[model samples]
Target: MQIIKLNNGVEMPQLGFGVYQIPLDETEEAVYQAIKTGYRLLDTASVYGNEKETGEGIRRAIKEKLVTREELFITSKLFILQTPEEKATETIQYSLDVMGLEYLDLYLIHQPYGDIYGAWRALVKAQKNGKVRAIGISNFKSAKMIEFVGLNDVKPQINQIEINPWYQRMEDQQLHEKYDVQVEAWAPFAEGRHELFENPILSEIGLKYEKTIGQVVLRWLMQRGIVALAKSVRPERMAENINIFDFELSKEDIEKIAELDMKKSAFFDHDAPEQVEWFMQRMLETEK
Candidate 1:
């Protein structure tokens, strides 16, 4: 597996298994199978409601001697409600307890809303106390990210956002670079939108290297120095996603893929007021 060194001198797998919407009942088996297939990094979030199951899977892998605890990198996010410093610290502890782990490889603020500065301060304290290895924020745009960095003493080590060939996030990438922040790509396949799996351009590029379009897309992102998280429930697909370590995309192909950039998010726009309202309402409803 290819590893990237974060600003904190911590090494993270370039590719990881994301359990975004994996069902609670199936998370354990899926995570277990992913580990069996050689996936060392597992990504889950507090809102996913399956941290315990994911931890179960990791324990199963360790008990079976498939992999040791030290060999795995586990990540979880702080939900939107867990923003105020008091709640944020409690949430961090809750996630650690639920996951049955002493420390998280990485913990992200999940979203850029509601007391982000307070939550970030909590994360910095956790890092100092050795509860988290690295801290970051997800779904934060350039302006918000810059503000967060300026307001904090310990700049965020990472800024994970929606990135793919369709939404290349070139400007965001440059901004992160300037701040010495690593960029992680979520929805790297655009959730298979725009017929990404069947795109002629990606297909043709895949044919050159005898690989699949999904693999091509992931390889392109990694080649451009972006950490790509590709998720799959099936073990075969899980294995395929990590097979990207062998090949490299050429300068010409890289340029060709760059043309597919739409410069917009395929998902909801966080900048829009209505969307922010929707997120806030959804969080309130979920709590009830």
Candidate 2:
């Protein structure tokens, strides 16, 4: 697997497995299969309600001698309700206790709403105390990201957001570059929206490479220098997601695929107040 060197000199896999909607019961097996397929990074979140299972999967892989702790890059998120300074610290500890790990490879504030500054301060402390190696925020817009960096001592190392052929987030990517923040794609496939699977341009490119539309999209993101998190419960798809290293997209093919950008999210917009309310409600439900 290829690695992206962070500003702090930490090397993260360009491709990782995400367990966003994976059921707790199935998360272990799915992650174990991903490990066996040579995936060293596992992305989970507090709101996902499966950190325990994710940890169990890692332990199972370790018990079977599949991979060591150092070889794995485990990432988890701090939910919205956990954003107040006190709650943030407590939540970080709780995640560590639940995951049964000494420290995390990456810990992100899951959303832009709520007491994010307070939560970011707590994460900074966690990093200082050796509980988290790298800290970041997911789904943060450029203005908010700049505010956080301006107020914090330790700048965020990454900004995880939606990135795909349909939603390229070019301006956000440029902002990340300005801050030296690494960009990670959450919905790399746009959740199969925008007829991504049947795009004539992508289909033709796939035919030339003998790959699927999803593979073409993923490779395009990687070539553009973004860390991508791909989730799949099926073992075959898991292998397919990581099989992107073999072929290279020609410059012309890359440009043709780039032209497909619609520059907006297919899912909920983080900037919308109602969407923010919905996220808060979901986080509250998960906490309850």
Candidate 3:
């Protein structure tokens, strides 16, 4: 696995397994299979309601000798409802306890809502207390990102966002670069939207590298220094996703793929008022 150093001087896997919506019961098996398939980084979040199972999977993998605790880079995010310093700190501990881990490889403020300043402060405190190795945020646009950095003593080390050939996020990438924050792609395949798996251009580029379209997309992100997360419950797909390290896409091929950019997310736009309302409702439900 290739490694990237965070601005805080921590090493992270350039590629990882994300358990975004993986079923709770199946998460353990999927994570176990991922570990057996050579994936060392696992991303989960409190809102997924599967951190316990994710932890169970890691324990199973370790018990079976598939991997060790130290070899794994475990990540989880704080929910939007838990942004206050007290609530955020408690939530972080809850995740750690549920995962049965002493420290997380990384922890992030999951969204750009609620009391983000307090939430970031909580994360920074956790980092100082050694409960987390690195701190960052997700789904934050450029303006919020800049405000976050300006307000905090420790700048965010990573910005996890939607990035794929279809939504290249070139402007956002420039902003992340300007702040020395690493860009980590959430939906690297655009959640298979735009028939990403069947794209002719990507397929043509993959042919040159003897890779699949998914692999080609992942390699493209990695080439541009983005940490890419490719999630799959299927063992075969999990293995296939991580096998991208062996091949390299040429500059011309990458440029060709760049032309496929539509500069938008295939998923929801957090900046939209309706989307914000929906997220607010989610927060309310979580509070209940």
What is the lDDT for 238 in model 3?
92
Cα lDDT computed for each candidate against the true fold:
0.91, 0.90, 0.92
Q: Tell me model 3's lDDT, rounded to 2 decimals.
A: 0.92
Candidates 1 and 3 compared by lDDT, better number: 3
Q: What is the TM-score of each predicted model, taking all chains together?
A: 0.98, 0.97, 0.98
Location of the lowest summed lDDT over 10 successive residues in candidate 3: 279-288
Tell me how many clashing residue pairs each candidate has.
0, 0, 0
Candidate 1 vs candidate 2: the TM-score winner is 1
List the lowest-lDDT window of 10 residues for candidate 2.
Answer: 279-288
Candidate 2 whole-model C-alpha lDDT, 0 to 1:
0.90
Which regions of candidate 2 deviate over 4 angstroms?
A: none
Which candidate ranks first by lDDT, i.e. highest? 3
